[model samples]
Target: MPRRVAMILALLLCSGCSSELRNIELQRVAKDWSLVIRASQIIPVYPLTEDLQPGDTFLVQRPIDKQHELYDERGFLPLENLIHRVNPRGYQAFYENSLGLGGDAQPIPKRWLTNQQPWTQAPIASFPTYSFSVRSGSGFSLALPVQGVPIGLSLLGSDAAQGTITIADARTYGVDTVSLAKDVEDWAAQQRGFLRNYASTGAHPNYLRVVSRVYLAGRLNVSLQSSDSSGATASGGAPKPVELVTTAGGPGPQDASLEAYKSNLAKLNELIEKSLEKTPTGSGQALLPGGTVKVVAASARAISLVETFSRPLVVGYLGFDMLIGPGGTLGPPIPTYAVLTAQLEPHPATVALELLDTAGLRHTYEVLTKLGRRGDTRAADLVKQLDGLGTLVPRQYPCNMFHFGDAAGPLSIQHPAGTALPDQKGFVRITLYLGKLQSSIDDLERAQADKSLKIATFDTRDAAVDAYLAGELAASRTALRDMYRSLQAHGDLLAQAQEHATQATRKLLLE
Candidate 1:
């Protein structure tokens, strides 16, 4: 019983990248203005808390010695490795600006910034910083106790604005970025050649840009003020005027069809929800130390193709397999199992079935059908003999998960095979279906088909065989068709969402 597997190495829902405007306006200061990017008085601090006061200065920098490189992008890099500190007089100006006093604790609720995420926390996942003070509370600062890292910073300069610095929050790589610059000049120049190309091209074409081996991802833009002889800015002075950028929605031609599509999609989701409600739910225990990781890859199929078994199994007893299979080489019409992801509802009981999908599945079925009809009627006996070989024939196969976390990297996401009928009819039927499916898949691969389609499901659901066992071909046929329909119903779910999003994006574009 080979189970389908989907693998992801990082966070979920990262559907490509796009540039976004940060709300953070730097240098909006009154006293002792060094033009720092502090927590905003208009909005609560990330990981919003009381002890960690508002207006906490965000001092982002790498260690005194490290340089930007791929090795430095590790997300688990300690917060202390980077810098997150508030000044001694961090909130002095903010207090007077607001209806408050110096050092008086003010929790950010309605009285504070309660807007959407104003800025992205690039290269850094939002982590809690504990509050502490020194020098009798003058240099009170928020200390990064754990769970965040600062990658390198980007510098954008204009001939118009100098001697004015700023920093905005953003997320890139959904992990840490560490580029240690000796000074501001050094930082902005970390990837100057590539960064310049980034702005000129206005397209971050790839998921990564290798700058001195530091994998720069998306949404990273930091500004620099005037620097001194030492290539650093003075800590004290009247901060220069900060730059401003406004957010606006661009106009688009009316797309009533897209709007209608959205409305229909909403209804489809409702229908899917009701249908999925009848499917059994399943979960796998993550190995100790690290729990199950989240899935991020977007898949296309709704129905499951793997047969469920009562027997337990550890997927990837072999090696880590990827979710996305071969490209045009495998041909058009992605494998149904490949399109069927864990993220889908009623997670059909989920990868790239490379040899399994493209070669093995087809060949296995072809040989089986040929044998079964070889006049010797040896097909049934051959399959029974294989199935009879105990675990060697394998009702279930072991597989690996895509690993990235510190936890036990080998956590299995599938349940073991359950009870099976003595007759092996379910297994026999699956081979025949797979045999038929292999030809279609091969034909598509050879044609390099542009569209995906499914005619038969290879899911070996043992319970359904009860209908066949009772000599009810019509009932079995109906059951098979229902499963296929269910698979389509579920699989179309991803399509509906992608369609709605794609169309809605037409609105986001500034006409």
Candidate 2:
């Protein structure tokens, strides 16, 4: 007897007659095999949203203007090309003068600084750098090695003798220093712009200014120092200063005057212990990498949309933007955004095969059995069927849909069905250069008081290596140039480093 078929009766109910059932059936095949899938990351773009909501969900689908005319503003390919060139990172600076100002001050952590260079050894760490500060009449200026990047500085201060402090240079000290806290806020705003504008493509803004302020010296006065255009003596261009104190806050960190410590140091110890638990680094995790993944063109949008929906089970049909390299023993680096990743979570194909008989889908059932019939000897053919089946439909439908997987590109479907797909001519995946995040967080926690100092140190070192790679001649030349600049002025350094790293890494692109 011939093999029997399995049937599924799907029913629809109505008001009058008894519900009619459509009995759908599929033939039973002799052999069976399972399937598996893997994909790296699928960043979604706005084209996927058919409808818009309010709030975060609405913002997710909100249409971004295509007006930037990347090709016009910066020729299409060059702007696209420059994106891979910039590797941006941000560091926060916290300092104090004899006046005793206490609070946190972060640089503008703009989005442009988020891209990871193809050559960057590891993904960017999302955490902020913590530091301490000390200010006096003749302020101290000390520069340290940052992974060797040339970093500039901006000081937020207030003098006790002077009623109010003033910050004159908006270029180094951003434009919006209306308030002490404004610096932090404006910095964040700039970061968002970098993510949305410059980093995605090569649309470089004219300038990135620092936000700054001046506090009157007393309990906690702080102010920004102005840089001289001529690059002369400290006093020739120097602004008058005030008192100072700088420290990375300690466990159970608490502020007290000498008078508070006149008698017992025991109470001070307990207070310090309490503060440790509340410090930013107390939990031992860093901030998530901050940046945006933009899909500028229609083709980029379609690719991202398809891959996102086909995730887990549909590895062959994705366009992954980034992948965190596996760690030595600690697992993969913590991804900047989990939901936006392409890493296979629950393999979809394998799951679908496990439910072959239970799925009640004829096409799925047929695919499973056909590849299993010839056993192990024909495994290669089966693998091709499971993976690169460019054309499998019957002669009657000669120009039907075809599927192809690209471990290096996007998994895509094409038709003799081409209109809906994006133009592949200018297609390229631009990966930014961001060095691996620091290996440990212990140092960051310890240097919390000198927030600006520590960040500046890292920027100086990172930029130095970047400058050397960019062919800036001497290492000392790069270091000296960085000495005069502050971490607050490192936008160009990060961008240049990214450019070099991307060029070096492109040689490793998958075939």
Candidate 3:
């Protein structure tokens, strides 16, 4: 038998026990349901920024009057300028210095450095913001500037393609040495590695954290597009390409050594690669880059990139922000997790009424019997009138049922059994039930003044309400039934009270 049924049977068999014992048993059963309901409602918390120090526990509390929707925002830093093209002589010097092997690598003069710059800086200021919309299981367009060059973009949810990154515009701006398409694909793969590591070592396994990190990290220069267009674009005309310049003086022992520059460049590349590899990928197949970059005029620098995810996101906001470190280098990207609560339509009034009836029926019956035993006919009739009030009240259930976003699993139990009304209505019903029950108990107290009797009655009602709020309708229902059975077992006490009242009536008649 289910534990619920077993507990019911045990309570019925022990009906002859004192009311105190029955209340204790009912509380025990109510606790079991409370645990389950509480577990389902718990939402895990995550760090919003990478700079969170140890021993800090962030907890978000709900409003006392109303509920608010949750929004999650994560920021992704851009890649720092690192890779630079070099001639055979410059390459040899960089290679030897990087490996720490002593060799006479001739340093290219500062005059040559100005003309032979490897990477051209794209004017990022031209496009300050890109407006885009992403629907669940749909694709959207994105336009962003990389190294100051504008690149057009498109994105598809996981429903379309899995783990694929396709680049549309691939023009070489400066010396045209690095493959932008190949680098993007490699970067996607590295991001997938980061996700895998987080899943393995994160304090808690959160799907939102994994999905958001990968999606934000894969695309560079992402930012939430604003609905309004004001201030969206920079005031200046198209930004001109800027050349990479080193501040080091002319070539000499006093000048900045080529060996030192190469070593620093290698370190920057290593750090960038490490950051890329640790970022997570979108849900779907692993991302593979295979598209070609279209080299067009510098004026027509539009690259349309398409990325497909595994699942659709109802993204209220999607975009990236730049965090520039010292020397204009991008800082490390941090993971962010968002918790959303969806508003659901109210359930039928019958659902809540059914729960109230199931949990309150026994209590109702007990109150009626006690009133009858105490010879309080008026109180008994008033208590009986409450039975029809359910019909007079509105049938709409009021509590707002909530669930997490698509990343998390669906809500545990939409509506628990026993007419689980929303919080407000449930509390109202509990108050009415307690009021009527207390009226009968008060009359009994005036007649006999038994403290134990009042304690037993209050204890049972309190336990039932506690169970109901926790979504343990069945337990609350059973608790009420136990209270009824305890009252029925008090037949001898009721008989004595009735006889006393009858004798008093006879004495009044004789007078």
Candidate 4:
């Protein structure tokens, strides 16, 4: 009887232990659920390459520019080609400087420089090279002539102790003749002209002279050392002084004068336009000039624009379709491109998101599914319909099927009808949103994990349970808001997709 009583006691103890374990499990689950809810409140969204706000005006260049003269004509020549040629050189230099690489060395981060087409590796060939030096004095002066014209004169690298540099437009200064002599004689003649002008007029006028000066911090007893015209000492005993080297002609074709160069460019453009006019319109075959034609035209335009206006004109290449409908009932794709140059202003409603790869989208869909299972009915319904989102659209040029977000699979819109042409615009826009959603979902899961650890420290089961329940309530509110936002974004994507499909069908019929 005593042994039987002991066995009963043992059984009772085991049962109590089992109950405690079950309670602990329940508390853990509650805490985890609460953490997940809190995490859902803040989802990390992808940032845009160029952040934009409302009322921003950005310059966009697209291949959609019609080949027809009626649609292509403009008062000012498009500097697209010139910008392309010159910008690459400037970009190379800027990037090299940024990476601390010197003199045509490749950057360490080569991936950033890689593009669909191989980059041209040739160096700039036509610019004139120059070198100069200054002696220790109150000021100094130098003049460089290119093609018989003094294009630039400055005191850019002069030292205060070495004085300043003065420039006199020889023609305006009543000095009609500039000696091409290779010695200090030419410099002496310039100095005499300056003296004669000063003696004749009490003050120099803007058209006559341009002078720059820098004051020294401390006075020094020094005399002007005799040197050759090259700013090098005749004695040749002193250490070689640092020389300031500059190049003229920039990255494009050279001319005797900027004005002449501009005139030549205008003529060239007129000729090209005339040639294009002769071609059959709407043939999709606009005649581009041969032998670096685009490069020459682009460089000329870019140089002229910058020199004349001092404002940069940004340009880029874009590819998209222009669809026309029979009754004009068809909707056009959003008149926006992936690349934009805009003057931005603050607008809370404007947001841009990018998903560079596929994995990001899949992760987003998984998170949405989790949220759906956790009592988000809207999310649940949307998730169910995601698979049937987009229809395949046919392309005319290359003649192949195009899929949206296929790179980021499963969550991507599967082409609904085999006969239907994919809406390229819808495909691109929806793909972008899918990437954004995926990124946010991934963030939610990470946040939940972090919160779970904090809730785990509760010593009492009742305390854990209370915290978990409180977390759930807070999370539920946020989840509901997120669900609505997701639905809205998805709805827009669907609407655009339908519009794109309709446009495609109309375009095919018209064709």
Task: Give one digit per residue, the lDDT tens place, for model 3 in 53-112.
Answer: 111111112221122222211112112222221122222333343432213443322222
Q: Every model's Cα RMSD, please?
A: 30.9, 33.4, 32.3, 37.5
For residue 95, give model 4's deviation from the true position in Å. Answer: 30
Q: RMSD in Å for candidate 1, one decimal?
A: 30.9
Q: Write the per-residue lDDT of candidate 1 for residues 1-511, one digit (tens) a residue.
A: 0111011101111212222211111111211121011222111122222223211212213221221221122211121221122122323333355435334464222223232431122133221222211111111111211100000000011111122111212221211111111121122222223333322111111111111101111121222222212211111111112111112234654443455445544443343223223422246322211111111111121111111111111110000111112111111121111111211111211111122222343354345545456543544454444343222222321111111122321211122223231334433444443333333223323222212221122134244433322232222223333323332333333233223333434544755
In Å, residue 411's CA in model 4 sits off its true spot by: 27
CA lDDT of every candidate: 0.23, 0.20, 0.27, 0.26
Residue 385, candidate 1: C-alpha displacement in angstroms: 5.5
Tens-digit lDDT track for model 2 on 1-511?
A: 0111000000001111222211110000000000101111221111112111100000111111221232122211111111211111222222223212223332221221232321121112111121222122122221111100000111112111111111111111111112322322222222333333322122211111111211110011122232232221111111112111223335553534443333223342233223222323456633322111111111100111000111011001111111111110001111212312323331111112111111122223233334335352333343333232212211221221222233221212233322232221110100000000010111222233232332321344355534432331122222222221222133233233333334433533643
Q: What TM-scores do the predictions have?
A: 0.19, 0.15, 0.20, 0.18
lDDT of 4: 0.26
> Candidate 3 versus the native: TM-score?
0.20
